[model samples]
Structures are given as C-alpha cells and as structure tokens.
Target: MGLAVGAGAAGLAIGGGAGIAGGVALGRARERRTADAVASGDGIHQPGITTPVQDHLHFAAFDMMARTTRDDVASLLQDWTYAANRMMQGLEVSATGAVGGSPEAPPDDTGEALGLPASNLTITFGFGPSLFDERFGLAAQRPAGLERLPAFLGDDLDPERSDGDLCIQACADDPQVAVHAIRNLSRIAFGRARIRWSQLGFGRTSKTTSDQATPRNLFGFKDGTANILADDAAALDENVWVSASEGPAWLAGGSYLVARRIAMLIETWDRVRLSEQDRIVGRDKARGAPLSGGDEFTAPDFAATDGSGTPRIDARSHVRLAHPDQNGGIRILRRGYNFVDGNTDLGRLNAGLFFLSFQRSPDRYITVQRALATDAMAEYIRHVGSGLWAVPPAPAAGQSIGAGLLGA
Candidate 1:
C-alpha cells in the first residue's frame, strides 16, 4: 500500500494539503516535563508540569526506498548530522536567551527537557522497519512495531527495539537559522537514500492548554473541561510512553501514532451575540470560568438543578457533560499551538489554532470532540487541514540517532 498522511485539530482529523504537512510534522512524540503541581479537585496532580518547548523545530522523514543498504544509510547520515549540529548552533543565537532574552522565554536547562520549554528550532526524524530491512531483514508496519528496538530514539519509543535504525533529532533557539539548516540538510540527504515522506514544525507559543478561569475559546465557556492528567512517572510511562512488543527485537526502540489538523472560523463565530457564544461553548467569554458559578480550575456541579429544577449544568452543557461528577471526569491532556497566516479578506484576521493532543487511543479523546463538531459551534469552524503518520520514538544513550536511518 502507498503511504498515508494526517493531522489532528482539537481531536478531529481533516484532509488535503494540511494533512500532508501535518503528517510529516505532527506525528513526532515528546513531552514537556513540569516542575510544579497543577490545581485539580481534592488535592493536585503534578507530574512535574513541563510544556513542550515551542521554539524547537521538529522534522520527521520516512525512507521511500525499502531496499537500501545500512552502510550507505550510515554514510549519508554522518554528513547530515555534522551539518545539522552546526546549523542548530547558529540558530540558538536568535532563540530566547540564546542571543539575549528570548522574544518569549529563554531555554531553561534546569529541570527535564520538555518542562515548559521553547527553543528557536527542534528537529527530529524516524526510520521505519523498511530502513532496517535493507540490513537486518525486518519490515516495520504498524504504529506499535517501533517499540521493540533497543536504545529507543528515547523520548517516545521503547529501549529494547531501537537497534539498527535511523532516528535523529536536534533543537536550537532560533527559527530562521533552523529553516535554512534543514533546507540545506534536505538538499544533501533527500536523494542519497529513498525518502518516503517528510515534515517540519514551527511553534509560536509555549502554552498548549489554558489555565482554569482563563478566557476560553470563541464559544465563551472556559474550554478544556475534559483534559487528562499525569501524576507520576509510572502513569506517564504507561499512559504516555510507547511499548516495545510491536517490532523486531532490534526495532523495539521506537513509537508511532497518528496526528490530524483543524481550522476554526473566528469571523463567522464572532457574528453571534455574546450570549449565544456563551451558551454554545458553555463558559464565560471574558474569564473562561464555568457558567452560573465555580472558580478557575473548579469543577461545575452538573447535578445541581437550575431555577426551574432543571440541571444547572445542563445535560448538554459542554463543561457539565464533560464533568458529569464533581470530581471532573471529562479531562484529556491537551497540547495545542496557534497559527496565523496573511489575511485574504482585505482588512480582517485570518488565523486559527493547530490543536494537538496525546492519548492512549483516538477513541477516548476524539470521540468526545466528534460530538462538539456537530453542535452549535459547527458553523463557526471548519476542518481545513489534516495528516496522519506513526511518530517514531526518541533515541537512546550512547547512540547518535539518524545515523542509520538516513543511510548516513
């Protein structure tokens, strides 16, 4: 079968140009570790909250030639690595603090890597079983197949199956320098080996989810009523980390998952009156707090009856339904970004969100979003972008990833 690409928006998956680009960019996996505790119900769940650094650029490439030799791949990659490292060094000067104070915040080396970070550019790559097949006699097929290799490309894949594969990632504090570096790298490496598909990502902000009480989306209600939590390492490992049983013993070090893109219609959405917008999203427009009551981060009481004895948090209220119980059950881990393009409407805004989330499966997170898409907010938003691909896991210790996969 031919290769397929996809991207995620909130939760839904769209198709076309955005799909192909998102496919190459969105499928990469990495977590921003946090250093503080988040306020949730009774106590708090703080698995060291860290945001996925935005300034870092991410690039994922697939090998088109399923029949190339491993030695050739290694030779080509060696040259690519030298080039990328030098490029990242230069990009760092423009990044937050790399040169001076970041336009945003400079890179914080203190805590773990993903802990609320943003670099000028972050680049990563993944190799399928086909890349390994040329030398090890194995073909990686499904999303799970990447987990068994040893020395996982590290952040996303398992450690047992990462051997004999090409997985490379690099990050810096600059954007313009990063783009030029990658363009140069591609020109040199693209034809050296068989490239299947490739993608690049640029992040403009570090905050993916809004804090409680923060202004919600166009719908007016405090958004993110349903977000997942990560309280400890074990949970993070189980719920967030990829496994190694999917691929060959030598290929167990990787991970894979699909990503999709979505576009929101702010202009059309703005046409509605304030009250209508609030009713649809179920949150206050200015504060993004729960309607009829509750503080930022506080759960809404769904069972409490309204003036006529009807449920205060209506059965259909986005927040109420997302949190059926006072304990808040409708939570999903959200990690999205914002994107803005030039205006085509003469003198108006033309921008939207690049919604992204990581979950065990699409069924849990996406199922809920499907319902919202058909709700009152449907007319104000459209699925204009999409892409899909299995994100290969991070690289392990003592190994310089990308060396083997790129036929370096």
Candidate 2:
C-alpha cells in the first residue's frame, strides 16, 4: 500500500509467483502461474486471494437490512452468487440484461459493463464480526480468532466506515467491470442489505505471477517485490488459507481478510530528504533493495554497516521491523492499492495506501502490526479506517457462496 508493511501485510511469493499449495483442503491448487485466468481458484477457496492482482478494486461492506429473516439473508446470498458467476463469465447479470429488460421497468443488468470481457473479474465474499450476532443465527459458527481488529498505534479509524455485517471484494482489470459488479450486487441486495462504507481503488500495488512486474504505491516505491503468486500452492496453504486444525469447520479452507485505509501525508513526505527517506524505509527507493545490500529479491541483511561504523539500516526502519525475520516468521499476503480521493480543503491531496491482506488468522496480522508500532514511517502515515472479515471457503460445486457458514 501507500506506506509500508506497517499498515501493510506480508506474503512474498517464495519461488517466483503464487507458491504452490501443499496439504490444501481446497481442491487442487493451480500448479503454475498462468498469464491470466478469469476464474482462477480451484472451487475450494474463493478466487480473489491467489488470483493475479487486478488493476482496480471495488470493495464494499454491507449490513443486512433491519427486520430481515434468516431466509432473507440466504436468498440474498444465493442471488449474489448466481449474479457474480454470470458477470465473471462476461455475461449479463441476468438473462434479460440491461437493454433486453422490459421497456416499462428498470433493467436486470446495469448495462455499463455490457460488451466488456470478464477482465479477469473475481468476486470474493466474507462475513464480518457483526454478522456473528443472533440476527442470522450464526454465532457458534464464528471462527475462534474472528473479532474486531485490535486498536493499533497510529490508528485514526472512522467508526462509520470501519466494520460491517458483510463484505464483498470485487477485483478486475477494468474499473467499469469492477464497479458494475458492486453496483449490481448492491441492487440485487435490494432491501436485504445496504452499503456501509465502500472504497474505490486503482493502480494495484502487488502482483501474483511472473508475467506481471512489481507495481508501485503513491509513495514512489515498488511493492509486491515478493508477494504471494497466483500459482504458489505451498505458500497459499501455509501462509494464506485457514487450516482445518485452526477452525470451526465452516471456515477451514478460507482465510481472514484485513483492510486498512491509510492516509499518506503527501506534502510532508515530498519535503523529506531523499537519504532520510531511504533510511526511514530502509531500502533503495530506486530498486526497492534493502540498504543492507543485494538485488530487490536479496533478503535484507539487518546487521550490515557503513563507513564510520554507522548501521546501514535504522532500527526503526519499515523494512527492518516488518520483515518476517523480525516478526516471529509471521507473513501476510498483501494485495493493496494506492488511493487518492481528490484533495482536501487545504489544497493537499487526500491520498494513501488502501491496505488489503489475507492471512490464516487475524492474529497473523495483529502480530506483524504490533511489531511495527515503532516504525519510522508511521510518522508519515495514519490508518484511517479498518475491518476484519472471516472469508469462508468457496462453496462446493454448484453451491452458493456461503452454503457452509450459513448452513444452507
């Protein structure tokens, strides 16, 4: 994202691209990182996780409408599943589609995405902590570590924008397609669910395959230099997917999602000295290689030193503190984005990193974040909004999205 792993999560592709999954409960994990696969996941886990990071993101959180029944919730999910599948296949949301609908009424498909290919679209659904309450009768099914994200240092979270009963992460190469997916899904929700707070992001800061090069955040530094790949089956199993031994059966093959809206102090950063900036980040801004030396992929040598006997890396540097070596070997998969919501009244750009990470558990993130409390870059950024969602495994063949947790 905009800042660094301090507001970020980690999952570096160990052997090139998305690592291969080993003892996965989800069906056969893809063996190789293809250039592209519109429907990439193997039907066991959702598509967005290991799928190649898309160019745009339309992430939304929803709260079920008041006075709705369990059946209402189930119906909404079924409707969402069917429609999401259709859109991913590059078809209309319904048979009638936008232009073919009745002239006397609104159209089934919004028509905005008509004629556009799938654009490798993926729609991932998740259940927020609030949904574990009695409204849907799903308390016992809540995974053990599923709860509101703990307060972290430098958090400026907005109450109205943080948590929700449900969340949907729609990613695609086309912004229109991504937006259309959320818009149509919201329409399908109708009176059953309404948007809480949503974020629109573009310029992906991570990649999952060898074909895609490392992308950069607004901070002018490359990210995803070592992120999980689309074909790394092993890494997916160990670092991303939740294991059966760690779960309440319903969430076994799924992973937890952490979202943070970080605001970058653009003006302040633009004024910092280049050398000081490199020291704060602990990497060569030009190559993303550690100040400790080596190429971008060279593991950082935290103990390297310079002339005059000064430490090459600052103790509080972002890379030094956030590295897995320093975090009890905990790593999270990051697929974050650099975001800019125009400018503020003071004529400064309201921009930052929209941090997104998928981990085996929420604690994985909490652990890494906790280690970054003293991050030097924390002075240049502030976490504005946050959330945690339990992403259930992909439904069985021919089943709707949440058939497991909802027990439908």
Candidate 3:
C-alpha cells in the first residue's frame, strides 16, 4: 500500500510540472499568433496588449515641444546622426565619465579620441501604467479598448525580446537632463499602468597606446567588417515588421522591438586612418556602409582582395566574422543610436555605441551579437545594456484595457 502511494505522488508531481510547461508553450504560441495577426491585419485582438495611442502622444508631444516642426520626424532622425553632436552635449557635461563596473575609474582619454565617448552615454526612461493605458491607447477595452493579448510574465518580458508603445529620448550636454527627461516622462504616466524603464552606460580600463587602440584586435588587423546597417526604414518595415492582420482592427498601426545597448572602446580604434577605418568597419567613415559596397544591405565579397593584396573581408573585420564562411545566414536588424560624454572622468572621456536591435526572437538577434562579442571586436566593444520586454499587442476596444494580457 505504501509503495502504491509513492507511485501516485510521483505521478502527481510529474503532472504538475508538465502542466506548467504546457502553459508556457501555450503562451508562446499565443504571442506568436498575436504578432502574426497584427502583421497580417486580421483584426483578432489579444487579451491585454496596449495600442498605438501612446505612439501618437510621442509624435504629438515632440511635434509641439521641439523648436522645429517642419520636419519633426526628420529632426528626430537627425538626433540619431553623429556621435558628438549637440544632442549629446548635455550628457557630456554631466556624465562623470565613469565605467559601469567601477565608480572611481576615470574615463579613458584614448577612448574619447576615437569618437567612442560621443555615443556611449545614455539615460533611458519609460512611462507608467497611468500614462500607458489612459493617456496612451492601452486604455481598457470596456469603452475604448481594442482588446489584445494578456501581458507577459518573465519569459515574455525578457527585455531584449519586447518593444514599447512610446519612447521619449533626448540628450543634452548634461546627463541630468537625460535623466530628467526620462523621469519626467515616467511621472506623466504614473497614475496609470507603468512602463518598464532603466539606464545603461559603458565600462573598462585604458590600453594607454594608440597601437593598443588601433582598429585591430590582439590579432593585429582592422575588424567589424560585415555588420548589418539599420535606420528607421529597416527597423520599422523590414525587421520589426510583423503581420498581425488577423488581430483586432484597433491594432492596425502597431510596431515592435525598441532595443538599446551601450557598447564601449574607442581609443584603440582612433589609431587607424579614415580609409583604413572604413575597411575595418566595413562601412564609410561618414556613410556607414560597405567599403566595396553599395547601400547598407548590399553584400561585400569577403573573398575580394584590396590593392594591398589583403583579403577585402579581413578575418578580424566585424562584417566578416558576423557573416563568416561566405554564408549570409547571420543577420541582425540594428536600430542603434550614438552618445558621448566628456564630463564623466573630470572632463576626460568615456564613449562607445548605444547598441539597439530588434527581432522576433532574442536568440536570433543575440546569436549574431554573440558572434561579434567573441570576434576580434570583442576587445573593443563590451555589452553593458541588457533587458527584455513584451511589447503588448495593440489595445482593444470596449473591454478591460491592457489588463489580462499585459499582466497575465
């Protein structure tokens, strides 16, 4: 009788575990379907997702607030341009020029020379529930919602995987303003549902010499040759492009994946010439594309040789390693912005990239980046920004706004 009881207990335990696993599998399937529906324009709404109302707020607020409106979107696009531009002036002044791991470590000056600090500094902020649901379009479906999927838990909410409804970002000469802008936005959304938020920056010690900073790795050659290029065009239409045609009608104008990262290491990169730099990076120093290339997506022949008889696709090149073996299998959609700080280490420097990319699966995007991290560029760029989120499906109408799906 005792033996029988033990067998029954084991069966119950196994059944319980299986039940949880089933729930997870179901949730993922639901999430995938929601993305597909929205992409396909199907109009079937998920239970707890948010809507594009927030995106409207972002558009309108910036349209009204900025000094220029003729090209508000254009200006926003411009904000993403250069590394040490006026947009980051505020951050450069207020930033302590400290690395992520050490509070006392000073910013590396060589890093500054290579234009690294011009883009590494960043302060991120997100809206709260109040602003997200009511002020934004995620309001309950009872009277105005479109009805979408339920909110995600840990698995779905992985920062790298999700996107946000609205994003308000700006950089001045000081980091304080960046912090202020983010915090202020959060306040505006506080009374309702809260959005996820965090700040990410850079790290590291100095190699002290330009040779150490040379665009090469310990392997001694230029690197980062085949990185995929990204602008709003690629991100909005090509990559984050989901087909939710089967989703609820209200979710018609939704988008996904607002990824961000803080990549560092500049001093060593400055030692190379502009032309050499272009080859190492696999993009024009100013235009950011292939050296033997056409547009951002145009493929460069790795096997091509340069005038120096060197492999056009340097083995250590960022592009070569990312798309190695002449195989085009790896591709990550990048939507990154640049930042800089000259004030962090008592006005010295700390810089790198504000890495951001989006994809249907974190594994897909992360796998490509992992290759870069281990490639020749690893010594230069270290990942400091990390988070995952479940961009809620567009909101539904006349149900509970962004409730079940968002929190479920």
Candidate 4:
C-alpha cells in the first residue's frame, strides 16, 4: 500500500486514493532519476553508495542458516534483488502488496509505509568476511583484503552488535520507508537467513553532493566539511570504487563499506569548556573553520602559529590528524548518521554517530583509523560496534545481485 507512484527527481508525490498497484513505472523513474541510476551501461555499481545521503537509515546484517546450501544463497539474492529494485521505485515487495494479497495470507508488504512516497529509497547489499569460508565455497573468490577489521584504540566493541555474514543498508527520506525496506527484506530471508544486528539512525551526518550542506554530528561540530562530492568522478575512482586491476573481478566498480557504531559521552562533552571543545575538533564553534584561520572550506593550516608562537592547530586535533593532506591524500566517502537510542538506565542519553564510509579497499579505512589512534577527541567517543563488507557490482536486469560471484 506504499505509494505506488514515487515522485521522481523533482521530489513530488500524489498520495491517497491513487491506487497502489498501477503506474509503478512512473514512480520508479521519478524516484531514481539519473543521478544514482546504474552507472555503467551494464549497471556495474550499486545505487546507495553515492546516491546523496538520505535523512534516515535502517541498516541490518544477516547470516545464512547452518544447513543452508549455495543454492539457498543464490535464490535469496535473486528474490532480494527483485524486491529491492521494486521497493526502490516506490512499489511494494510484490504485485499483491498489503491489501491486495489473499485475506487468509499475510500481506506481501508491510502496511507501515502505506501511502508513503518512495522518498528516494535505496537498498545497498554487501558481503561480510565471514561469508567467504568453505560454507559457500567462496574462499577462492574472496578479495585479498577481505578480513575482520583489526583492533583500534578506544574500542569496546559489543559482540551482540558487531559482525554479520551479510549486510543491507536502506536509506530514505522517510523513516518508515527505510524501515519498511529492511522489514520486507528480512521477511523474504526468513527461512535462509536471520538478522545478526541492526541499527536505526536519523539526521544524516554527511553529504555526497556539493548542493547539500554538511550536517553536524552528536558532538555538535560540522562533520565531513570536505567530503568528496558525487560529481567528483576522479576522486571516487581514486578513493572509492574498486578497479579491474584490483582482481576478484566480481567487485570491479563496487566498493568496500565500513560501519562503526561510535558511542559518544555527550554529557561529558557538553560539560567541557567551549575553547577546549574547539581545540578537540580543531574548528570554529559556529562556522566550522579551522583553528588556523580560514572558512569551513579553506584548507587547514596545520603549521600556522598563535601570538605566543604555539601551533594554531593542535597536532592531535581531529581536523589536523584526519585531513587528507596529512594522510597521503587518502579520503573515504562518508554517509554517516546520528542516532540516539533513547536514554540509558543511568538517566543519560545513549546517542552517537553511526559512521558509514566507502573506500576502494579495506586497507584504506584501516589506514585512516589507525592514524586516528591518538586523536584528541578520542576522550569523548567509544567505538562500540564495527563491521566491514565487500559490496559487489550491481547486477544487470533479470540477474541477481552478486551473480558474478555465485555464477547465477
């Protein structure tokens, strides 16, 4: 019953009494527009990777059942791909959506998102390191860099929320749309796979297009002020999508995704003095400019000095340490979100950033995170849960996702 006609790139919709089953193609075309459409003529890359971050996210990880066979995984992907493609276009999981299904049977699509526009929904799939073992006979096809992420400083990762055999990231302007996506997908995988962990997030903390303003994190600083824009194809090639030469041919044009659930000690940070806060983030409190005296977009002057000859930008400051200039020009495309899962039992707010980034290789993320081992802001955040997945190229029409690896 969700809006059968998704408003396209223009971002408009006609809801209520329009009939949910017809005019589905008009919804698909308007909802997707060309910006995030399949990039290669063969549709070699997935949509959500660079499709301009949406306002809400419902990310879930899954593991295949113990007795599930290779065919099970293949069939799951085929069904999931078809459903995902349809849902992204503002259609239901199937033609017999919600109210259309037989009265005796459960609705094919959840009714929660009924009457909602597509809201620019996008579903991206990924394969985790654990899925590369003999279970599926995929060890030989595994990319060389695919492995569990090594430990880092200030980590208190929770096993209950850490790794999974697979992951799906659903993003949309409407919270209901995003959640609806994961719900239906999970329903479809019921017999073969179950959820390992999931996170619901809001208030996107980054942007993929220059037109969108940089968003703030729970810490109240502008995050990703210099994030790579979607128009910068050169930057994406250099830092994001995997290339043919990288081998494991199935992943070319695809990217590696890293998700870190960072728990912020927001109360503690709120108590810190403004000056100290600025130093920790290394940016002006109001404008997000570097301490070295420049606007938000100006290149930070790491070596500039104050009146007393002290370095204007602290070497341990987050801005200084995470800058591409200091890290061999390495950058990851961030599509993070802010999350507050209500309050903890202690009467403190349990909130933080759900950081999501895409890079050409896993090593790229490891290198950057390693460089942040001594970050000044480390005092205010804890890396509580983490995961890394190798995303495969978008499949051609009628083909299931990851057909390259499964030979489906």
lDDT of 1 by residue, 240-309 (tens): 3334554333223333322233346667777889876766656666765666667655655555666898
TM-score of each: 0.55, 0.89, 0.43, 0.91
Candidate No. with top lDDT:
4
lDDT of 2: 0.78
In Å, residue 287's CA in model 4 sits off its true spot by: 0.2
Tens-digit lDDT track for model 3 on 1-408? 000000111211111111000010011111111110111122232211111000000100111231323233222222221111111222221122223224454331112212222121222222222223433234452212212223321122334322333344333223433344344333323332234444332221111112222132222333333333222344333434334452333222332233444445566566656666655556555544566657544676777777899776567666665673433364444333344545345442455544443343344554555555435555555454444322333222211122223322
Top TM-score prediction, candidate number:
4
Model 1: lowest-lDDT 10 consecutive positions: 18-27
- What are the RMSDs of all candidates, in order? 14.0, 8.3, 21.4, 6.2
User: Pairing residues by index, what is the TM-score of model 1?
Assistant: 0.55
lDDT of 4 by residue, 69-160 (tens): 88888877776776676677677766667888668867777778777778988788999999998898999999999999999989999988
Backbone atom clashes (below 3 Å) for every candidate: 89, 17, 108, 2
Query: What RMSD does model 3 have?
Result: 21.4
- lDDT per residue (tens digit) for residues 41-117 in model 2: 34566767777788999999999999998887776776776677666667676666797756887777788987777
| Better candidate number, 1 or 4, judged by lDDT | 4
lDDT of 1: 0.37
- Cα lDDT of all candidates, in order? 0.37, 0.78, 0.32, 0.81
Instruction: Please list the residue runs of candidate 2 whose C-alpha ends up more than 4 Å from where it truly belongs after superposition.
Output: 1-41
Lowest lDDT block of 10, candidate 3: 52-61
